[model samples]
Target: MTSRASRSGRWMERLNGEIEWHPSQAVTTMTDQAHSVASKLEQLLKAVANNPSLERQLKMATTASAICEVASSAGIELRPADVVKHYANRLLSASDEVSVQNFDLCSWDAGELLWAMKQWT
Candidate 1:
């Protein structure tokens, strides 16, 4: 039997793939929204990168609540899970072990974090 984590990972992969290939107008809208949310998340990550205090806060945060508090203090309006969902592909592509923990942001390496902030051109 597949573990819960394995099943969730598969579900996310399928959902993300469907978001790309499904040809319905509603799907298109959802894709656009996901991109927009990702862009905002990228901006937020960049902002964190440039601010030592914010970067420290994020790096030291061990719980989702702490991360959300830090993000809120930094003026990021989205919840951590929203950002994770929007940037799921980039994060997963960076590392196979990079799964979201308890619907919260997982710790990311500097390179993967920077990659997430890179704007789509």
Candidate 2:
């Protein structure tokens, strides 16, 4: 009886040890996907800024799409025109108008805040 109990305990321990434990793979995958999307968005924004035609069309397309995604993530539903208006208003706020550095800085700060919030919460 003692040997039988000991053998059963060993088997149980082996079974438990063989089992793998991970909190949530889905959460990890989602975070990875979000990071990939953000990286691609930044790359696209840079591409748009480097060329006038790309900039115009991207402003009319990619920029609006990206803003929509951001707005959706932030629980806001905004039109492209509204975004453009807000952007124009920001442009007006600058005494010397706007520069590419300002554009990069804006997105960089936004991304920083976003990642920070994710980490904090």
Candidate 3:
């Protein structure tokens, strides 16, 4: 009778040990899944940050190609050149025009200025 009781106690201890291990295994599996999901989300965010909108990129490329074509037709070679002096000269001319017009400078908001500048571009 004593041996039978001891054997039964050992069997019960083994079963309890397996039951404890099962929950830990489940917890580890869940942790791994969570980590995978977090890593994918981070990668998606980085991709979005690095890539610009396709429509905008297409528009810019088209405009640049058209400019090159027009330049080629006009017998003008298109080369990258510093246009800072040209831009500064234009800005100075615009400032002179704005100064000549005695309008309230405070009323010229940024949005209005940007809209006016877009015409030159």
Candidate 4:
């Protein structure tokens, strides 16, 4: 075999090993995950809105991971990616006037956050 083909085969081997889901299941799995994350986001937002202690803890959280820790302690489900995606969606819908890089938020994964944003550009 050609050297390039040998390297390509090895790369494919590693890729297949690292990925668990079948190609047919990828979309359904991702959709389910998205719904689960959205549910957690809604739950966390409502909890924060209704509970002053939870709100305070969230506000005091220094990072998205910290916020997740706080929420988890309060029996709320939150993930760092969920926090990143939440802000991504907010910014995507926000007016262009609000793109200030002010330290108002905690975590950032803007480049990889939203697949839908690719449609906007």
Candidate 5:
């Protein structure tokens, strides 16, 4: 009878140990998944930060000194965030024909600015 009780106690201990191990393993797997998700989010943020539309905005706003001054005053150094801000500023200031012409010159989709570049040459 004593041996049987001892064997039963040992089996229960082993089962508890196995159960504990699984939770720890699950915790580790969850941690790894969270790290992977965080890394992907960082990469996405960087890609958005380096978007090309921002560069196009800087190029268009810098087409004229007046526009460049406005862009510079807005603290946009041709970087992604600055490009967005500069574009927004230009759109807000787009009341006059000069502003409209400059905005068109800086259009991101169409290669219209190349015409101005050719004329400059």
Candidate 6:
């Protein structure tokens, strides 16, 4: 899992409070709007979980835009950037060192969101 760990190392470092934000770099904070989007994301995922057809559609979605379309059809407002920030907030809000270590790698991979969603099934 070296590649997985390496790919997610930035989140790991941020969890440990090791990252110092520079003005030029983008930082994701848990703003109210972001939280709202994250909640919408949760709503979309839950809808998919409860609907077999939706789950299948979501599983077949190959890109963030496709996923958003699926979510939109479910009446949930979500975006790719929202998905990215969702994981960032999750990593940033880790309650303990162990939880940080146990952070789900698949959840952090932007390209593997469909895979991650399936894993939750």
Q: What ranges in model 3 sit over 4 Å off? A: 3-5, 12-21, 54-121
Q: How many residue-pair clashes does candidate 3 contain?
A: 0
Count of backbone collisions in candidate 1 = 0
Cα lDDT tens digits for candidate 6, 2-99: 68778689677776585476534434444666778878878988999899988999999876788888999899877887776666667777777745
* Model 4, residue 83: C-alpha shift (Å): 2.9
Q: Tell me each candidate's TM-score.
A: 0.45, 0.36, 0.32, 0.51, 0.31, 0.51
lDDT of 5 at 59: 47
Cα deviation of 105 in candidate 6 (Å)? 4.0
Q: State in Å the error of residue 111, model 5.
A: 44
Per-residue alpha-carbon lDDT of candidate 2 for residues 39-95, written as tens digits (9 for 90 to 100): 555655565566676565545544666665544543445455655555555566666
Cα lDDT for residue 33, candidate 3: 52
Better of 1 and 2 by lDDT: 1
Model 3 per-residue lDDT tens digits across residues 1-121 = 5798899999999899878466678878756755554454344344435556522343354333443333343343332221223223335557766744533443557787789899879
Residue-pair clashes per candidate, as listed? Answer: 0, 0, 0, 0, 0, 0
Instruction: Quantify all predictions' global Cα lDDT against the true fold.
Output: 0.70, 0.61, 0.49, 0.76, 0.55, 0.76
Write one digit per residue (lDDT tens) for candidate 5, span 24-108: 7887875675555445434433544576653455445544453334344444323344334545555775778867787777445
* lDDT for 90 (candidate 4): 61
Could you tell which candidate, 2 or 4, scores higher by TM-score?
Answer: 4
User: Candidate 1, which segments miss by more than 4 Å at Cα?
Assistant: 1-23, 63-65, 87-121
RMSD of each: 15.8, 13.0, 22.8, 10.4, 18.0, 15.7
Clashes of 6: 0
